[model samples]
Target chain A: MDRTIRVLVGKPGLDGHDRGAKVIARSFRDAGMEVIYSGLHRTPEELARMAVEEDVDVVACSILSGAHNTLLPRVVECLKKEKGTEELDVLVLAGGIIPAEDVEFLKANGVDEVFGPGTNTQDIVEYTKTNLKR
Target chain B: MFSGYPGGMVLYLHNQIIQGLCERKRAGLARAVTLVENGSEHARHILEEAYRLRGHSKVIGITGSPGVGKSTLVDSLIGAIRERGDSVGVIAVDPSSPFTGGAILGDRVRVRSRTTDNEVFFRSLASRGYLGGLSRHTGDIITLFDAFGFDYVLVETVGTGQSEVDIMRYAHSVLVVMAPGLGDDIQAIKAGILEIGDVFCVNKADHPDADRAVAVLEAMLGLNRQWQWKPPVVKTVASQGKGVVELLGKIDEHLEFLKQNGLLEERVSRSYIAALEDNIRRDTVDRILTEARLDGTLDLVLTQLSQGKTYPAAVAKQLIGKYLCAEESDNQ
Candidate 1:
């Protein structure tokens, strides 16, 4: 059986701007991956809990509220702290109005990749396919 | 601990998962559900254990058309159930793309109010080409939840049309949610849906036509129906969590009706029958197709089909005879 890569597309924090998240979710679906979308205003704890419960291979955080500096790393930290998720090999990705300089910091803080504005949806899909830890 | 293990290592992980389940760990239940959803080789062992530990939970099926607030209603219902001191497990199903076998499961978005609560566990599923607005392994996952010791297991189906009455086979009480102004009056007259609903909910009651929708559903339900526990229609603004308590009350009343009349056992038996049929199809039809694909028999059949040399019915008969009857004869 072909393993279907499951992704948790989360918009953590008070950002109601989920257009980018929805677009990426559609792209992932079109690429034959299952996307579990966590709707707007989700806390990092909720995202991590959902990722663990859903057993997803990727945790894609879409932050348009410019809180990525604080929120994105907390998502990774919460996932690590979530019960039974310590062993889960999740590829964490961050996207949305992030500055280029902060991309390195995000990656160093457990985000595997950071997609800035104008990043193609297909690139995210291919990146997910290539970078999946499983 | 569940995936990518080899040989005996897989068995060890299965045992570990089972132990975790026995200890009532949330992670164990979550991983077990994933294993069942994936149809892993270890699923049978887990399901066997789950079946042995079943019968503690009430399975409620919530289904309706798209945008009828099924997920929102489920989220509210979860609150109601929790307020009554019952732990609930929610399995929300969404349709997968037929072209790509992928899906966007957005139900969890609406049903995320209880994320911090340990007693509330929500999992989203893709229909995965299974028609009838549900995943193929939905029943098995419900079993896992029941075994995990939840007091209630709520199943939210993919937005369904008229023919998706499959939810009735698994649920003790089927809640058919409808929003106002969806032309649901005419929908109420649809045969398959009207007959299967144990309780009907007209959601988005703040809409001007909410009363009309409820009246239409009641009037349609009253048409020539016998007095054996008539299905009640409740109105609710699910987004605001209004009228949810009444809706849950009506559902509980229906459950009481099922219990008093001994119909709950019938529903249980129906679910078992459905499970048996599903497993038989997996063992027979799925196994046959997989083997045929592996041995190039499917390629030959497709060639014959495209050339108009053999019809589908004839090919099906030949394959069944060769694969099934031949095995029977050999056994004899």
Candidate 2:
């Protein structure tokens, strides 16, 4: 059976803010993908294990506590170490409170994309589609 | 002699009953639905078996503010559908207590008396304080009916604002029932319900200001036609069954239009994809949270972060490193 692309949407760390995560989840739903939100305050390890177990094609983490720099690298490392040999094909993305310069820096260290506040939901949906395995 | 497994007789009996349901038996389907709605474990197994056999029912969801006469409106339309020789399945969702998870499904009183008629199947669901203001299990029940070969399945919900609007995702066509006095209520819900409806109904059209409400809806539609799908508005006095025939006609018309225009196929395929993805995601996340032991540490992390004792950024990095990448050995 050709499985649908599964995505894990997690708000890692102390970010109590979930409105953005929810909107993003809805956007994905509207775009016809399954989104599992890790609810609020998921640890990066928790998200990584979930991605592997759920066999998700993508892991999109939303962070607003100014933790993109600290959290992004660890998420990437987790995906590579635990799931790499299988070539499980995971794409890591981040959104919320990200500065412009950090986008490039995070992308260099394995973050595929960074969306700031006020980013249209359409853009997020497009990004997800583009990143999924054909 | 009893089977070795516990509850074996119950399962065996339920299977016999559900087998009759698969053969298009009404007694079995009705009894099965009642059992599931009551949350019986045996009913679940029967429903699962029945679901595998049923297919090809168009599920329609109708929701609106209380007193909009949704039940009366649906009751009237049921006759029209029956006249057309199509078997109909109706599921009405009513409010239940958020605390005790208790509900009173009173609308069944109106629908049950007509049970002797094989053309109609009526079932009511208890919303039971689910976040979306509809029963969590309502979708599954609809699926069971779909498998049973009903031509159309109707889901009625007690309106509770934005979340109830989510029902449109599960419907081939969504009818947002409104009344004459509820323009302000419409304004309140416009954010959620307005965008999703395929057809809008102004029930209680016999009232003095019915036209005024219709006019308001017309203006609302004028602003909303920018989407790929533009919903149409209809007026009805549901209590008296006035306009119900016309309403059914409109539904048929829309169904034809949607099918010919290719909108129906697009909608069903899109919703199916979305639902499939959601299920995978939910199952995946649950596995990680449960098996990776993240659930145990999650509370402590939250407490520390909330108390300002830990930096969220640093904590996030550590989580991915320890739990996610530790298997790699090098990363750890």
Model 2 in CAPRI terms: which quality? incorrect
lDDT, candidate 2, B170-270, per-residue tens: 67888888888765535833577766678888988989988888788778778744665566778887767788888877777777778888888877766
In each prediction, how many residue pairs overlap at the backbone (N, C-alpha, C within less than 3 A)? 0, 6
lDDT of 2 by residue, A1-134 (tens): 22344467877888799888878866775565556566676666666654543345678899999988998888788677655453436778899999898888898888878888888899888878887753
Q: In DockQ, how does model 1 score against the reference complex? A: 0.74
What's the DockQ for every one of the candidates?
A: 0.74, 0.01
| Candidate 1 structure quality by residue, lDDT tens digits, B232-269 | 99999888989999999999899999999898999999
Model 2 stretches astray by more than 4 angstroms: A1-134, B1-14, B30-54, B110-113, B184-189, B225-230, B277-299, B310-332
Candidate 1 retains true contacts at a fraction of: 0.72
State each model's CA lDDT, in order. 0.87, 0.69
Provide the lDDT at B60 for model 1: 94
Please identify model 1 stretches exceeding 4 Å from their true place: A84-88, B1-7, B184-186, B294-296, B303-310, B328-332
